[model samples]
Target: MKIVIIGSGNVSYHLAKAFQQNNIPVSQIFGRNESDLKFISDQLQIPFSTSKLNDADLYLICVSDGSVGEVSRLITKENCLVAHTSGSLPKEILAGNYRKASFYPLQTFSKSKNLDYKEIPFFVESEGEEDLELLKNIALKISKKVMVSTYEKRKYIHLTAVFACNFVNHLYARAKEISDSQEIPFDYFLPLIKETTQKIEILEPKLAQTGPAIRNDERVLKAHEELITDQEQLKIYKIMNESIKKMYEL
Candidate 1:
């Protein structure tokens, strides 16, 4: 299939790389930024254009959530399939007359980070069985896990991801801030963080939960809270502890 990938961001670069690795040729990369597109083109050896877009069997819109609709309207091609790679967006978000679909890869993407595409889960949705099967087949080539999920389910999946990945990472940043305040090496917490995540592989998060809050150790919690002079960090610490206490009925 002749494939044209839209956008030049992390998702775009990673999708193009995944396709190249699986021997699926992406016909072209289309975007507004010439430099970013050129970088992808140079790295993946795929032809790209800033002004002109090529007609292809499939157009994968890899732009941001806000830009998905605006970018989808740019594809003037008819009798082709157009899919966006957004976990939070529905296939209906694409405003074109063509077959609308979504080819969401459920993983955080970074251009510099190499990932095992086979380990990534792809959630695909389409208007018809033919198009849906087309997307599923493509996804199956690069990933071991591919599921047909509706927008209703996909949105919830995205929301859960925010809690699991984004919010958790933000907490890590806040923890680093606290460590830096005391001149404590943030790297010292690496093993703790790693073990915390690794434990989830074999244990339910609720059951695997640990810490002063989980234990409801008032003395330790009070001492830690007193040490956190930063109001924002203190607030977070208190809120998290309260939440943990409520969860465990402590």
Candidate 2:
């Protein structure tokens, strides 16, 4: 099916590349910035436009959450199906004369990092059965895992993802900061982090709990609190320690 991708940010960059790799027909890529559009156009060898947006079988809007409604209003195509890659936005936000849907990819996108689309889970929603099937078929072309999800369910998934991915990544950054303060290489925690994640892959996180908080080792916890002099880090440590204690009823 012919497609036109909107925006030139990380999601747009990766999605367009995946479509190109799969030999999908991309009529054009559109954006407000001519230079950004030109760069992506040259990188993917696909024609791009800053003013003129072509009509296609499907249009994927990969812009920011705040701009999705504004961009959707700009698409003047009458019959073409339009979808956004937002995890939290409902399909109703694309309300207009044309068909609307959501084509959310449940993974973080970075332009520099190559992603295996085949392994990424895609959550799709459509207004009609035909359009839904079309979205599913298109998702299947790039990903082995595709699921039909409603806006309500998708929002919760997005919320949990914030905890699992974004918050956890911040914690990793905090750990690196602690290590850096002591002149210790962050790599020292690599094995521990790897094993912690690997354990959760086969066991529930609650079942795999360990450390001073879970073990109710007050001496160790106190020692750690003393070692962490940074107020922000100390606050986070105490909060997490209390959370762990509550979780395990230690």
Best candidate, lDDT-wise? 1
Show model 2 residue runs off by greater than 4 Å: none
Candidate 2 at residue 236, lDDT?
A: 94
Could you tally the backbone clashes for each prediction? Answer: 0, 0
Scored by Cα lDDT, where does model 1 land?
Answer: 0.94
Residue lDDT tens for model 2, 1-250: 6799999999998899888888887989999988878878989999999888887879999999999999998888788899999999998888567899999999998878999999999999999999999999888999999999999999999999999899999999999999999899999899999999999999999899888898899999999998998998999999999999888777
Give the Cα lDDT of each candidate: 0.94, 0.92
Question: How well is each residue in 106-194 modelled by candidate 1, as lDDT tens digits?
Answer: 99988889999999999999999999999999999999999999999999999999999999999999999988988999999999999
Reference-based TM-score of each model: 0.98, 0.96
Clashing pairs in 1: none
Error of 2 at 191 (Å): 2.3
Clashing pairs in 2: none
Lowest lDDT 10-residue stretch of candidate 1:
209-218
